[model samples]
Target: MTTSAILMYVDVWIVLCFYGYLLKIKKRIGFQLGMNISIVMGGMAALLSGVLLITQFPFHFTVITMISTVAGLTVGAVFGLLFDYQTFVTGLTNGIIIGLMSPMIGTVIERPTMFIIFLHGFFIFSLLTIFHSIKRS
Candidate 1:
């Protein structure tokens, strides 16, 4: 696998493990804590990814960065609202949208290979599942 693909896979795995841990301790802050943490992490990931793309890639930054930031904020806010509003369905729907958009955004910014996109999607969906399980439990 390419370096980027490996990174994406590893990132996903890390996110899954982290989210799992949060779920385990979710009762302390209430069940919604895991979801809250995930949203923050996701937002940070998007921001960091955007910064990385602008710094490391050949892409234009002006529009791409703005788009990425907006996307990140939207996803993050939706995630937060999912927990705050106690709307699991809304969260899942937003997750689905983010999952679909992530790879496309990744490609547009980083131009990663197909494998990278697959890995990205896999991790994102995994994160969604983790949250869903936490909510159900």
Candidate 2:
């Protein structure tokens, strides 16, 4: 598969794992609600980013990424608080981390060395999962 396809798969896996973890912890919440909220926030971010990229707005990629990250976090946090206040912090934190890291990592791996991009995703995902698992215990 192409690098882009692999990255997309990884993104889907990350979202699924995150949603599953949230559902397991917030048993009172509906899985569909959590998934829909995540998808909506993600979609909005993508749309905004695409517009900025295509328009070649004044700001560079870094600035655009930062704006999108903040936007995603704000939206997710608001949705979380409205839906299930208990998961707001978790969702906001996860959104911020994903937002900030994803763009920076993408920029770094835009060169010929694509393995670094996969490594970046793998390491971040692994570290977060391990940290959360340990925290639960």
Candidate 3:
């Protein structure tokens, strides 16, 4: 795997582990917070997967879109399952829409490296936000 792809995969692992942590305390999470968590996780996962996969395999937009969509749906569904059905559906639908659209954004970008770095930073920020929110609840 390329360095960027490796990093994205590592990110996926980190996010999954975070989901595991959330699963342990699912009861403490309210539906609104659950909805937010699912949306953030799903959208970010789709965006990252789409952009990185497109960068790595630029010639295969169709396949990459499918892959990214699945990634988003999976991540969203996993997180949403900890809460409720409404959260699950919301995440799933958001993932579908974002995953479909993200590859085009990837193609239009002038600087993939910088964008990816910023995205990862944003992902970290999102995680910290969720963690703090969880702590507050």
Candidate 4:
């Protein structure tokens, strides 16, 4: 598969993971953390958008990637603030991290890089979440 295709899949999975993690820990975090998440997401989204524009990648690729990152971050943040500020921020933060990191990692692997990233992230964050919970308790 092409790099763009792999990146697209990576993006989708990243969003999924972002939501998954948020659902797991939203109630445990606070407003400050949520605000921080929003700021990080916005910054990452702007950076990614700038890179996309400067690099002049294919039109669809740029549009899809940017939209996914920006829209997901914005909507997630809004939803989090509306329903649960913590959840929104957590989701947006994770989404930004995944969105930004996936493309770079995808470029390194020849094939099946998306799967590797997904598994790697799942395991790492799963452990982190568990650790955070344990620490809190």
Q: Indicate which candidate wins on TM-score.
A: 3
lDDT of 4 at 1: 64
Clashing pairs in 3: none
lDDT for each residue of candidate 3 in 49-105, tens digit (9 for 90 to 100): 999989888999999999999989888887878899999998998888889988988
Deviating ranges (above 4 Å) for candidate 1: 31-34, 38-87, 110-137
For each predicted model, how many residue pairs clash, with residues at least 3 apart or on different chains?
0, 0, 0, 1
The global Cα lDDT (0 to 1) of model 4 is 0.50
User: What are the runs in model 2 whose C-alpha is more than 4 Å off?
Assistant: 1-36, 39-59, 105-137
* Cα deviation of 118, candidate 2, in Å: 16
Instruction: Output the TM-score of candidate 2.
Output: 0.41
lDDT tens readout by residue for model 2, 51-128 = 333233333766767765775576557546544554466557656765665454444443423454444455465547
Off by over 4 Å in 3: none
Of 1 and 4, the candidate ahead on TM-score is 4
lDDT of 1 by residue, 34-108 (tens): 455545455545543453354345356556555545655555554444345543434444444453354345555
lDDT of each: 0.51, 0.51, 0.90, 0.50
Clashing pairs in 4: 80-88
Error of model 1, residue 87, in angstroms: 4.9
Provide the lDDT at 16 for model 3: 74
